[model samples]
Target chain A: AQSVAQPEDQVNVAEGNPLTVKCTYSVSGNPYLFWYVQYPNRGLQFLLKYITGDNLVKGSYGFEAEFNKSQTSFHLKKPSALVSDSALYFCAVTHGSSNTGKLIFGQGTTLQVKP
Target chain B: GAGVSQTPSNKVTEKGKYVELRCDPISGHTALYWYRQSLGQGPEFLIYFQGTGAADDSGLPNDRFFAVRPEGSVSTLKIQRTERGDSAVYLCASSFGPGWEQYFGPGTRLTVT
Candidate 1:
C-alpha cells in the first residue's frame, strides 16, 4: 500500500525565517506527491505537486518542495515564512501503479509562524 | 474558474436521522471526489466519481453511506441512519483526471447530535 508520513505534529518558526515541513512516502514505482494547506474553517488547499521531471517543484504562495528519490522524501519549504502561513499542512501520495484514484495522506503537521 | 462548491456549509442532525450533502464541481472537471475530515485529522477519501459513474467507492465506510452524480456535474452524498461517529466536515473536490491537481470546496460540516 502507498502511504505518506509526516514526522512532526507541529513546527514553530519566526516570521521571515525559513520553514521546512518534512514528508516521506512509501510506494511502488513512480510516486505522485502533493502538498496542501488548510486554514481554520476551510477545506484543504493545494500548494504543490510532484508528478514527473524536475526534482524541485515550485508551487502556489511561495512554497516549494524537493523530491528525493533515494530518501523517499518530499519536504515542503518556504524561504521566508509569513504569519498568515500558519495552518495545517498535509502530504499526500498516489501511486502510478494503482487506479485506486485515492490520495493517501499523512497525519498532517501544524505550522505556526510567529510574528 | 468558479471552483468547487458545497452546500449547507453547516449541518446539525439527530442520530438516526437522514442527511444529504451536495457538491458542484468545476464546469469541465471530469473527476469528482468526496472526503470526510474529522477534527485534527487529514481528510479521508470516501468515493470518486468519473463523469456520471462512481469509479471507486471503496473508501465509503458502509452501506449507509451513498453518493450519486446523476448529471455528472452536481453530486449528492446521502447518509442513512446517521451515527454520532458520522459527524465530520464532508469535503468535495474535483480534478480534470488522474495526475491533475484537484480543487476543493469549502466543505459541509456535519454534526450529528
Candidate 2:
C-alpha cells in the first residue's frame, strides 16, 4: 500500500523567507510523489511531482521539491514565501504498478505565510 | 481550452436526501477522478474513470456512493441517503490518461444538514 505523511499540522513562515513543507512516504514499488496546494474553497492545484531522474524538481509558482531516496522523502521548498502562498498543502503518493492511478494523500499541512 | 468544471458550487440538503454532483472534464481528457475533502483534511480518493467505464471504484466509502462516466467526457457522482458525515467539498479532476498530471475543478461544497 502507498501512504504519505505530513507530520506537521501547520507551518508558519515569514514573507520573503524560505519555506519548507516536509513530506514522507511509504510504498512497495517505485513511488510517484506529488505536491498540491489548495486555496480557500478551491480544488487542489498541482505544484510538482517526482517520477524519476534528478533529485531536484521544479514546479509551478516558484515551488520545487527534492526527492531524497534514502530518506524516502519529497520535501517542497520555496526560496521566498509570499502572503498569497498561505494555504493548505498536501503530499500524495501512488505506486507505479498497475495504472489505476489512484493517489493516496496525506492528512495535509496548513502553511501560513505572515506578511 | 476550458478546465475541468463541476456544477452546483454549493449544495445543502437534509439527511437521508439524495444528491447528484456533476463534472465536466476538459475536451480531450480521457481520465476523470472524484475525491472528497473534509474540513482541515486532504482530499480522499473516491473513484476514477477511464473513458466511458469506471477503471476503479475501490476508494468509494460505501455502496451508497455511485458514479457514472458514460460517453467518456462527463461524470456524475450520486449519493444516496446523505448523512452529516458526508458534508465536504467534492472535487473533480481530469487528466490526459492514466499516470498523468490531473487538472482539478473548482469543487462543489456539499452540506448535509
Candidate 3:
C-alpha cells in the first residue's frame, strides 16, 4: 500500500518554458523514487532520487526526472523555467521490499513560474 | 553540518493545552523522523527513530500522540488533548542509516486555537 499520485493542483509555466510536474505510483515491488522541493517558508529540499540505474534522473537546481516503468510515471522536469523556479512540488514513494525509510507522499504540486 | 533542527519555530496552542515539539538531528544521523503537514498537504509520516528506539509508530494519530528519542540526538514530540485538528506543520527528518536520504527541518508551526 505505497501510494503517491500528484495529479496537479496547479501548474503554470512561462519564464523560459518547458516544465512539467506530475507523478504517479502505487508500489508493490520495485519503486523508490523521490523528488522534493518547497520554498515559501522553507523545509524540504532534495530534488532527486530513483535508485537503480537511472531512468534519466538528474536533480538539484536544474532538476530532471523521468522513470516511467510502463508509465507508473515519475515526471518532474525542467528545461528552462525560472522565476526562481517557483516552488512546492513533492512526489515520493518507497518500496523494493522496504528497508523502512518509510515515505509515501504526494498531493502537492504548485509550480507557477511566470515572468 | 547542522541541518535538521526544529524547535518552537512558531506555536500557539490553546485547544486543550499541552504541547512540546523539538528535534535536532544530523550530527551523525542514525535516522529520526516525524512528519505532519496539512495546509495544502504533503508531509505525513508521524514517527520513526532508529537510534533511541521507536522503529516506527505507525503514523501516530491517536492516543494523544507522543514521541521521544532519549539520547539519540534529541527528539521530542508530545501532544495531549490539543485539538483543532492538532493544527499542522510539524516536521523533522534525519537519515544516514536505514534507507538513507532524508534531511529536513524548518517546521513546527502548530497553531491550535
User: Top TM-score: which candidate number?
Assistant: 1
Task: Give the TM-score between model 1's chain B and the true chain B.
Answer: 0.98
DockQ of each: 0.68, 0.74, 0.23
Question: Candidate 2: where is the Cα deviation over 4 Å?
Answer: none
User: Which residue pairs collide in model 1, if any?
Assistant: none
Candidate 2 CA-lDDT value: 0.92
By DockQ, is 1 or 2 better? 2
Q: Is candidate 2 or candidate 3 better by DockQ?
A: 2
Q: Please write out the lDDT profile of model 2 over residues B69-100, one tens digit for every residue.
A: 88998899999999999999999999887667
Looking at the true structure's interface, with contacts defined as alpha carbon pairs within 8 Å between chains A and B, what fraction does model 3 recover? 0.54
Give the Å error, residue A87, model 2: 1.2
Cα error, residue A71 of model 3, in Å, equals 21
lDDT of each: 0.94, 0.92, 0.89
lDDT of 3 by residue, A1-115 (tens): 7899999898999999899999999988888898999999989988888878969989888899999899899999989999998989999888866766878899899999989
Misplaced by over 4 Å in model 1 are none
Model 3, span B67-94: residue lDDT tens: 9998888999999989999999999989
Clashing pairs in 2: none
The local distance difference test score of model 1 is 0.94
